[model samples]
Target: MFGRPQLVFLLLLLVAGLAWLRLPGDEQRVRTALIMGTLVEIRLAGDPQQFNPAIDAAFAEMSRVEKLFSSQLAESDVSQLSFSTEPFQVTEESAALLQRGRQIARQSDGAFDMSLGALKQLWGVETENPQVPSAEQLQQALAGVGPEALQIEGRTVSKSNPHLQIDLGGIAKGYAVDRALEILRRAGVTSAAVNAGGDIGLLGSREDGKPWRIGIQHPRKQDELLTTLILTDRAVVTSGDYERFFEKDGVRYHHIFDPRSGYPARDCQSVTVVAADVASADALATAAFVLGPQQGLQLLEQLPQVEGLLVAADGTLHRTSGLAALEP
Candidate 1:
């Protein structure tokens, strides 16, 4: 879901080091905290005193969501639901996210699945020591890997197979970003940016009355940018093979797995999605990465408020017509 040190480095370079616009006004109130296993940054342009509290409130909202959605946490709704044999009732937040994930999985033709928890555990992609699972192990994991296994009815969810587990790494952070933005808006913040690692949600313009400039990190190059975008009131998210991966005898094994193959998605090197909401952008980026270039762009075309940029394995770049128009 998140790249490690490299992701942190790229975020610092883009959010802090890179200057977007600085104008005479209240000092930019910025707060950064470690949440959702990554850095979450919130920046507001307003009276420092008033906006500072708003920033604090926003971080609190993020933390609250993290506790509710984190699969790693024992007390989280996701964890409890995973361990339950009977129907598990969940919070409205959890139910909504799960329902949304199911819709995306169906739309992507199972290219992106929420029921891949067993497969992830078998491959050990989230651990420091990731190893390739044997064919037998892969088969066993695949038995519990399908969106149909999990059933959601209102605020209660149940799984036909007890082994079926759900992991929200792909969409949870973006949902948190949206929730944080809601908090900021309620606090009267009209112009702000909430960045969770590479998934970002923005509102209004910068202090200089200019659109916020965001640099897209090069998929294959470190400390280099493929392009920059000028955006306002939009969410931009990127999912890349470079984020989390391990190498075995010169072959790289990444975290983005193809539901059909039970292996890392090799169609695209990286994918960037821009949409009106962070959750949609984040989920679509992952789905597009699995679908590769042609199908990925086609999916974006069908989406009304979405556009995408896909970097293929051959180093060719592809973009939706809408995204191409926004390229700086």
Candidate 2:
């Protein structure tokens, strides 16, 4: 979901590699795993005994969610829905995610789409061998790429076009992070942070009562940070071309695709969205990245309780009115 396989690993390493300067009284327990094709990290500031069960439960919940939504798994609901033209009954969770995807597609004017699976496969962005498809192949793939082609009734979903494929890659990670955090909270974990690839969710404060400092990766620079934000009980999700891309003939082809053009969006290098929920942050980051700076900021302005930081193709940074104030 974060782009290519290697880029996903790099982003996870960048986030997990961040140095944690804990206070004298801060006792943090951390665990890391590669799940859902990305690195998932869970950090808790509490007693070790209390953290163990919570961490274990959190990871188990993430695995369950992945099984339900991952497009890679043939048994996943998303795969079932994609492979079959008939109305496929799914879990309430999958239904809800599909509903959310449709809403965002409408809100973003199709800038964010969940039915890009065919196009993704055509481009082989998630595969070990990725290549540019021919114009005819791209056109064929694009034919089935649109949110409107999907029909959802209650917990049943079917595509109007039999060739249409659905992919929740743009939003599933955020939902997984949300569920993991919920599991931790229910397990008596008062202060915890879940960083799934780059989509992060936090609850409560650090052991010292200070806000969690999350560093945003520089769009073009692997060893640098664009900025860091103080957050508590908030979600920060970033989508960037730098995360997964390949250069061909000096042209960089990345994973974040434009539904209309059937190619990588060229507006922004990366986009970070901060919101109350991880799902919104994740989807909006991709939407804004496709929308570019001017329109992307405009979309952020229209949404309540959502702020964004966009790195343009030229490497210039732009932020929502509120996010600028949060930067140092």
Candidate 3:
């Protein structure tokens, strides 16, 4: 779930020519690495000598969060969270993120759910082999899809149903990107941007002080720009059926699921959200997609400082009030 950062980065330079270019010692330093199961590309504009260390610390924090949230790591709390019936004590960060996720779930009427491990596993969209599950299997998984089953008291998190599986795939990536920016800002970097997969967060403008121009990828067209948004000091995220999917009998199944139905959310081809923070935008993008265009745009309109653009199943585009888009 992310806006096209490379597109934004390149366009930013082209839009502002060499006259404002580089600015000498305050040159931008970009580094990309495989972290948290995605390509995390960091752009920092300042003296490389200082920002380089900040990048190290930023990636370190991201790596830490990745290991903490990854289910494959036997030592991670998430690995034990799903099946454990006992009151499990997770780190404070994990608890806080879980609570925020639950709040979003409540606000969206289960449109965005964190406790979808069962449904996700049944579909296996991200796995080497993905398949559509039987109706009976979907019904069984749907029973464990609600966030109401998750109860968090301080750092202690437990589930009413011991079999409930909790996974915060998109939201956690957003959180990691936020954490990375925090580390960069603390280092006194003047301007920077961090793109984790498709989720992106910005700390400041480019060398020209203009809002960063980010392009939204066309849901049905690869390498095509659907639209663009000018943003600064904010995060933008896109959740789309095109990100991950499988087709069977001419039916396209994607990874974004509606907990209410335990199937791929088919109301929209994609949904993009912009907010003050990436985590909220990331989760809300998925929420809006599942809610469909009408209610999805309504939910986006109701939220303060949140905006969204939804591409409907019919290839029509809908957006919330106050979202400014530049023509592609």
C-alpha lDDT values of all predictions = 0.86, 0.87, 0.86
Residue 282's lDDT in candidate 2: 94
Q: Give one digit per residue, the lDDT tens place, for model 2 in 160-219.
A: 778888888899999999999999888887888999999999988886798889999998
> Clashes per prediction?
0, 0, 2
- Tens digits of lDDT, candidate 1, 273-326: 999999889988999999999988888889998988899999899989988677
Q: Model 2, which residues run further than 4 Å from truth?
A: 1-28
Minimum summed lDDT over a 10-residue window in model 3 is located at 19-28
* Ten-residue region with minimum lDDT total, candidate 2: 19-28
The residue pairs in collision within model 2 are none
Cα displacement (Å) at residue 278, model 2 = 0.9
The TM-score obtained by model 3 is 0.90
> lDDT tens digits, residues 156-247, model 3?
99887788887888588998899999998898976888999889998988856877888999998898988898888989999999988888
- TM, every model: 0.90, 0.90, 0.90
Indicate the residue-level lDDT of 160 in model 1: 76
Candidate 2: deviation at residue 202, Å? 0.8
